[model samples]
Target: MTTSVSAIVIIVLALTALGYILGRQRALAVSDREKTKLHSLPGYYGQTVALYVAVPAFLLLGVWLFVQPIAIESQISSDIPQSIVDQSGAKSLVMADVRRIANGLDLLVGSGGFTETDLANMRADFSNVRSRLASVGVALGSDVQPAVFEAAKSYRNIGKAGSLIRNIAVLVTALALGAWSWFRITPRMRARNTSETFIKSLLMGSSLIAILTTLGIIGSLLFESIHFFRIYPARDFFFSATWNPQFRGGSDLGILPLLWGTLYVSFVALALAVPLGLMIAIYLAEYAGSSLRSFAKPAIEMLAGIPTIVYGLFALITVGPFIRDWIAQPTGLGSSSSSVMTAGLVMGIMLIPFISSLSDDIINAVPQSMRDGSYGLGATQSETIRKVIMPAALPGIVGAFLLAASRAIGETMIVVMGAGASARLSVNPFEAMTTVTVKIVSQLTGDTEFASPETLVAFALGLTLFVFTLGLNIIALYIVRKYREQYE
Candidate 1:
């Protein structure tokens, strides 16, 4: 089954690639005008067709793949004797054991221990099932008794005979569309419309990947969170912000302080990363010579490549104590190894690469013509970069900053390792503070009971993080769309 499915996947890939190439060639070949020739290139047309073929086919295969085993097993279980199947916990165990035996190509005497006869019978059964499924699938284009196979593959075979047909509906559609488009590409054909539509859809589809991935992540989190919320009240989780999600009953799991910690640490981290990163961007883009830029840019980017856990360990071993003794101890703050300042500062350093790299890219993207114009107008280099370049890059900078902020808010390792797990709603940077992420890590790891408030609280934290970041990204994108300068 796996090998057969793998072959199907390979065929889909090959077909998609072929469709794409053919569509693009057809578009290019059909175009008549030179300048106002195409609103989009041939590649877009090809990609659009490829998407049409791949998405539907893949979805069908995935659905069929998921349901086939379940339906088969369910049917097999039903047919087995009641004496063998009737018992508490027996059904699950029996199903598991049966699946194992089948998977191993082993068989049992009516769900009992395997015999030589059982093995032969199992082989026969497998072969029979495979042939029946293959027959049903041969020409079945769309509907499968979803109770049996969810969604059938697109290739419809001949209906007259019960056995099989090589359904090539997708291939046929591709060929037909390709041929029609090719034939229509005359001096009068509006190639631009066809090309532009294809490009627009391809862009939209690419953009949807981020949205869908975000949705999928949040959806999974929401389901788990809903389960959590069922076991606990929403009000208590949100308002009781002082979180002590120890395995104790009636512990305070207030979200407010956890939220407070997240905000405070993020504020400090941003305060540290943003200004420093901007300065680094300025130094590299304006002040630094070519040699300096070469050495510095990658070296700075390498900061991002460092593992967060390594940074976490650094915070634990070095930064925590160094701060405790140098600032926290002398300033009358508690001498705790884990403090908000420690987490915040380390997090800020981690974010430096993110901010600097994005800022650098945006800065470089600002047209050098703008700089020459500024220079011609008697503006100093610094003045040009400050006024013209930075302003032009503002939208991109804002987007990058928001993305970084999201990262900071979502960061767990540094906070878990460095920030004290006490969910205190304190503004004092020297004092220990714990963020929502810290609580999530603490609660979810180790042996956990799903029903307990401690465990359930993690999902609530996740949802809050999700909503907050989602809102920020949405707003940031809106700003970029409306106000950001486009240098054509």
Candidate 2:
């Protein structure tokens, strides 16, 4: 299949290039006083024509290829003996047998080798049919026996002719279109729009694919989670504090602990990130010299480029234990290094770039006129920023913060590794805990026991997360909208 697909692509590419070259050369040759040379580049015109040839033909090929196999299989089924066709369960077996038989027949017709099984099966069928025919021949006498052979030969001839006609029609249609497109490539015509439209259609089609994929993921989780909710009451799943999502039937599966843990870490992360990010952005936009800004801006933004898994590993190996011994132990909380404070603090560090980068861009978007307006009012630089500049950029700044929060809420690895596996509801940041995303990870990570409540809980958790994020986005969008109106 891959080889055939590759062959198709190669064939199309070659034809497109050929079409383009022909188009460009023709366009140049047909240049006259009325038409002059084309307004667009020759290459663009050629590519445009090439796309018309390649795109439509390739699409036709795909549709034909996909439909051909099933249609061919249906035709083959008509040739199967009535004995195998009568039994209901045996029908499936017979279908498989037919596929093998058809493949073998194709190979034989093509002068290709057959496996021993194929050879034996074909021989057996042929011998049995021949013996029956000979018996019938003997019963009827040789003078009248020609009709039986004629009937068998007629059925085979009809089937073969039908298949041949269909193939010929498809091939001829494909060739006609290909030739027509190739010939239509004249110096006068521009096909750039047609080519671009084809490409754009492919791109637009992909957007729906992402939406569908998300829906599929959520749907699969939703159904399984519903099964879980059926076994364990929804109230218990939502409100209960103690979390034990094991294989046992009576195992407690409350989301409260996970919820609390998620909020606690997110709170800690935001507390660290918001002010720090704002300050960095302010310094970058208002205070940093050009030379320093050039290097430092990228260096700070580089944090966002690092994978979350790397951040998780760093937290597990370095940050979590350091916090336990140095911070939490002195503060008198829990013994475990995997604490909410460690995870939250490290996660906050990971998010610094997200917050700062967004804040920086928004702050710069604030008009210089606002600052000048404040200065003209006899206000100091610091006073102007505090009173006017920051306020003007507040909507965009808030938007950035909310977006960053959305990212943190969905983050899996850092919380899973650094926030501990135990889903405890304690407020003390030093206590071991789990999160919604962490549990979602635990449920879906490897081969899940699909019917199990443990597995189903992930979906319910996901639906919760989705609803929460959706709400946040609505709030952010609303806030941004109001802010824009006010500023405008």
Candidate 3:
């Protein structure tokens, strides 16, 4: 099958290349081998031919590959008995075995281990089909049922037919389109215009894919959240202060504790990062010499390149214990190594580069004329920066801060290792608490039924986090637009 698919791809490519050469030669011939006599460049005619050949063929091939398996499965599923499905506890599981058996049979016949005649005549009770398949690298969970074996045979037959039909259809379409475009090439044809139109359509399609993908993600989250709300009351999910989820039943699935932890940790991180990062940005942009700034800026930005997991390890092994021993323990606030302050402080360190880099760029973007104008008024350097530069760059600086805040809010690894997974509504930063992301992970982990509230709650948590971050972005955009209007 792989060989056949590869052959199809190579053949399509070869045809496309052939169309390009033929189309170019035909354009030159029709123009009496004079370039200026043609309506467009000879290459444009060739490109137009190539696009017509490849685009429709590949599109048809793609659609066929995606839809054929689904059609085949739907048809074969009806042949499996209800008893087999009941024994597996899921129809999907039975279908999974059927697919495995079908692939194994294909492999067995390909390797000359069993003839198709022998496969058809073999009885499940006497043949030990499972062991034969296992030898060929296909492991079944249990003995193959006779009905499942029959279904597998049908699946393979249908798949083979679909593949043959698909390849023929695709090749026919490509040849038809390629020939049509090839013969349409004339000395007066607007090849350049048609080619440019195709390019523009391609660009538009790329943009539409991005927009549609975002919409698809939001749609999925919204649908799953709606399902969750139907099972659990919206009022309790929103207003209740507890955070507990149990698969057995009767769990207190509240948002308040997780929300509090998220906000509190983010606030601490921002409180530490914003002032320090802003100061670093100011120093680098205004005070530091070229040599010092060159070295210092890269060193600070390097922090952003480090993985979050590495930072989490640093928090767990180094920062957490230090905070517990030096601050929380000595101050009698809390004794736990995994505390909100530990995660926040470590996350703030990780976020420093993000805030500093963005703020520095924003500050530097402020027109130097603004500083000159301030200095011309007899103001000192500090006065010029305080009154002129900061205000000019305030909108962008706020945007950088909000972006950092969103990063802190959505963080999971540092919170998991440093702040622990005990969701609680508390004002004390020295105590351990968990955020929404951590709970979302915990709820969705392990093999659980998606129909249960416990698993569905992860989607609800994700939707809430999405909304919160989206609001932050909107606020940032509004501020940027408003300030740009005033400044301009």
Candidate 4:
């Protein structure tokens, strides 16, 4: 059956190619025989025929592949004994066992360890089902029962028959469609318009899929978050100052402290990144020579390409110890190395390339005539840049900073490593704290039941974070658009 799917695909592709060639040849033949000009080009006729052969065939193949399994599972599920179902109290679990045993039997036969008659005579209770299956590399949880074995055998038989029937149907559909299109190809047909319309619809459908996928993600988060709020107090989730979740029960799950930590770290990162990155961008765009700019830009941008986990490791191993030893210990700020300062500093270093690269491009985009005009007004290069160029590029620069802020707020690894997982309301930058993203990871890490408040709260945190980032993006777009219309 696996091979049949691939074989059917190959046959459809071959038929499509044949349709294209025949359609082109037929169009040219009709044109020459009638001594008349074709309505559309010969290539358009070929494309129309190819689309007819490929599109409907592939669509049916996809639909059959999706539906056949559900139909088979339904028919086989009814055959499973009521005693087994009641004993397990979970029909889905029993069906899973049936599927596993069915696969094991197929493997056993394919391995040539048993003849077809030998397998047919084998009994689940009398035979060593576990050991025999393990010998064939199909592990089983327990000895198979008679009812499960019978169900598995029936499942395998029905699946084989369905696969055979599907192959025939797919091939017949492809050939029929191809022949119809081939015979319809004529010198006067509007093949170009039909093919172009199909392609346009295809592009529209592709774009809609992307938009629908984003909406689906938002819908899932909103739905689960609403479910979480129903069980837990929405008031406490939004406004409570404490964040402590107990798996057993009676825990305060708050977002205020986590939100504060997120904002504090992001603020520190922006404070560090904005000044230094902007300075670097100014020097690179306005003052640096051509040779220096060529060598420096890529070298600076390479910092952005490094994976966040590597930065996390660097924070954990190198930066954490150094900060704890000299800065925190001597200054009496805090004892812990993993603090807001630690994460903020590392995140700032990570954000440098993002701000610098984008700012550099925006600074460069300012026209040279503006600088000349500033110079003619008796202003120096530094004055011109500060007054004229910065204003012109301010909108784009603000957008870049917002993007960086979003990156800092959503960051997980650096915070997890450099900022210890301690959610607390603190003003001290050296104190250990955690962000919403870290707590989200902690909450969802192991075997978790979605119905529990402890687990469902992750969705709540995710929805809040999504809204925050989405708001930042919208504001950035508005600022950029408004100023772009004014300046450019």
Name the best candidate (by lDDT): 3
By lDDT, highest first, what's the ranking? Answer: 3, 4, 2, 1
Better of 1 and 3 by lDDT: 3
Which segments of model 2 are wrong by more than 4 Å?
Answer: 1-11, 22-45, 56-177, 184-193, 196-203, 206-232, 485-488
TM-score of 2: 0.71
Candidate 1 residue-wise lDDT at 87: 40
In each prediction, how many residue pairs overlap at the backbone (N, C-alpha, C within less than 3 A)? 8, 1, 0, 0
Q: Candidate 3: where are CA atoms >4 Å away?
A: 1-14, 33-36, 76-80, 83-164, 485-488
**Backbone collision tally, model 1:** 8
lDDT of each: 0.71, 0.72, 0.90, 0.89
**What tens digits encode model 2's per-residue C-alpha lDDT throughout 1-488?**
34545655676677677877876776566565346756566676666666666666666666666676666556545655565456423344455544443333434434434343543343334454344434333221222222223333333344455545544554445456556765665545655665677679978877987998889987876777778789779998888888886565668888888888888888889999999999999999988999999999899989988988898898899988898888878877877889888889888998898999988988888888888989999999889888988888889899888987888888889998898888877778888888889888787765435556777788899989888887888888888888852333
TM-score of each: 0.63, 0.71, 0.87, 0.83
Worst 10 residues of 1 by lDDT: 151-160
Our tally of clashes for model 3 stands at 0
Candidate 4 Cα misplacement greater than 4 A, ranges: 1-15, 57-173, 335-337, 485-488
Best by TM-score: 3
TM-score quality measure for candidate 1: 0.63
Residue pairs with colliding backbones in model 4 are none
Ranking by TM-score: 3, 4, 2, 1
Compose the digit string of candidate 4's lDDT tens values, residues 304-395: 99999999998889888889998998999999889998899999999999999999998988888899999999999999998999999999
Full-model lDDT, candidate 4: 0.89
In candidate 2 the C-alpha lDDT for residue 136 amounts to 33
